[model samples]
Structures are given as structure tokens and as C-alpha cells.
Target: MPHLVLLYTPDLETDADIPSLCRALADTMLEQRDQAGKAVFPTGGTRVLAYPAAHCAVADGKGPYGFLYANLRMGSGRSEQVHKAVGDSLLQVLKRHLDALLQQRPIGITVQIDESQAQVYDAKHSSLHPLFNRPA
Candidate 1:
């Protein structure tokens, strides 16, 4: 249920490659499972996407600015520490992915991990969950 959506300014398109970033994020979640001993997300259920806004304004309306905003939405069952772990791990990936952009210019990256309310949230999954659980 961990779905990450990335929104960036137009100029950062070069640094924010959607397909590659998505795979990286999915791998990061899998790494959490390997390290923390928990299924952070289903392999087939991980959804990481990127969207470049048509119009964006940051700081001031002076020069071209780049911004990377990642929002992670998941089911509500984890502790604050777990949330921090996810956020930190995700931030590391985003930082590394956008390192060159940041080094060459002034860019901002933010990662926000949020939980969905169990009462209102609804989901539909498939047999892919079992596929992911199969022995490697």
C-alpha cells in the first residue's frame, strides 16, 4: 500500500526521471523488508510516480527554481518510528537521485510520509501479493 507520488518543477525533469525513480523507490521498500524484517509493501503494489507541474513558482518569482516533492501514502498501522524510518530512507533516495541537480543549482527536495485513515480508506488488491511472497 505504499504509493509514492513525486511532483517536481519543470526544470528538474532531467533529474526526476519517473520510471527509474519509481523502480528505485520500490527497491528501497524491498530493502526495508530485507533489513527491518517486515513487508513494507507488496512488490506488485508499490506505485511510485512523478509529475512535472505545468506552472510552478518557488521562493520568489525571480529565477528558474527546481523543487522535488515526494508524498508517500500508506495504510495506517505503523508507529512514529516506523514512519520516520520510511521517511528517512525515502529522503536518502530522493537526495541521491537529485544530487547532481542540487549540486549544480539550488534545488529543494521534501519527503512526506502519511498514513491513510482506516475508517475511510478503501483498497483493491490482486493475487500479486502471493506472487511476491513466493520463495525466491
Candidate 2:
């Protein structure tokens, strides 16, 4: 699984365009693969979500500052290049999408990519894939 969680300040809600940002990040990971050209993260397994923080404290005091922190969690057995590509791709999307808001207010953006062991990862699901399948 490739899960991207974006934690952004509520002040950005007006201009952050969170939905589009999430889609961009998810598309990047779903379309790209590892150095060996293996699609470890399936399209259905790619997830990108956003959370707007109502209360936040930034380095530039508590006025009009904002922050966007992203965490990308993936299963183990991925190449370092893959991790770097995913994180960098998402980070680029965040910066590019929020460029105007960032220029207006001091905003700090960061992204972290982490891996969890396959043994520790637990998954349970039903046969609902067909419902989400797209028509050709």
C-alpha cells in the first residue's frame, strides 16, 4: 500500500485546493514504479488523503503562518530510489499547487516517506473490487 497523508493548516483551506493536490500525488505514485520497473503499489492500493488543522503553531508566530506536512507510508521491499521518487513527487505537487498561498503567507512544507515491514502490515478486505472497476 502507498498511503499519503497531508496535514495542512486550516488557513490554506481557502486556496490550497486540497482535492486536486491529493489526486496529483496519488496519480504520481500509481503511474510510476521502482528502478526495476515493478509496479509494487497497485492503482487500487494508492491512497492520498488530506487533513486541515484548525489549530497550529508555526515558527513565525501564530498570525497568518501555515504548514503542510505530508507522510507517505509504503510496504517494505521497495528501493530507496522509489521512496525518494514518491516523496519528491508529492512534495513537488504540494509546492506547485500552493505556490500562491505560500507567497501570501509564510508556509513551511515537508514530506516524509516511510516503510513498514510486511509481517507487521495487516490487511483484510472483501471482494468489492468489481464495484470500483472502470468500464472500458
Would you estimate the TM-scores of all the predictions? 0.86, 0.85
Model 1 spans > 4 angstroms off:
34-36, 125-127, 134-136
Which residue pairs in candidate 2 have backbone atoms (N, alpha carbon, C) closer than 3 angstroms, thus clashing?
none
Where does candidate 2 have its weakest 10-residue lDDT segment?
A: 124-133
Off by over 4 Å in 2: 60-62, 118-121, 126-136
Q: Give the TM-score of candidate 1.
A: 0.86
- Across 18-56, the per-residue lDDT of candidate 2 in tens digits comes to 888888888788777777787757777778889998777
On residues 29-97, what C-alpha lDDT tens digit does candidate 1 reach at each position?
Answer: 767743457776767778888899998889986866788899999877777777888889999988888
TM-score of 2: 0.85
* Local distance difference test values of all predictions, in order: 0.80, 0.80
lDDT, model 1, position 83: 83
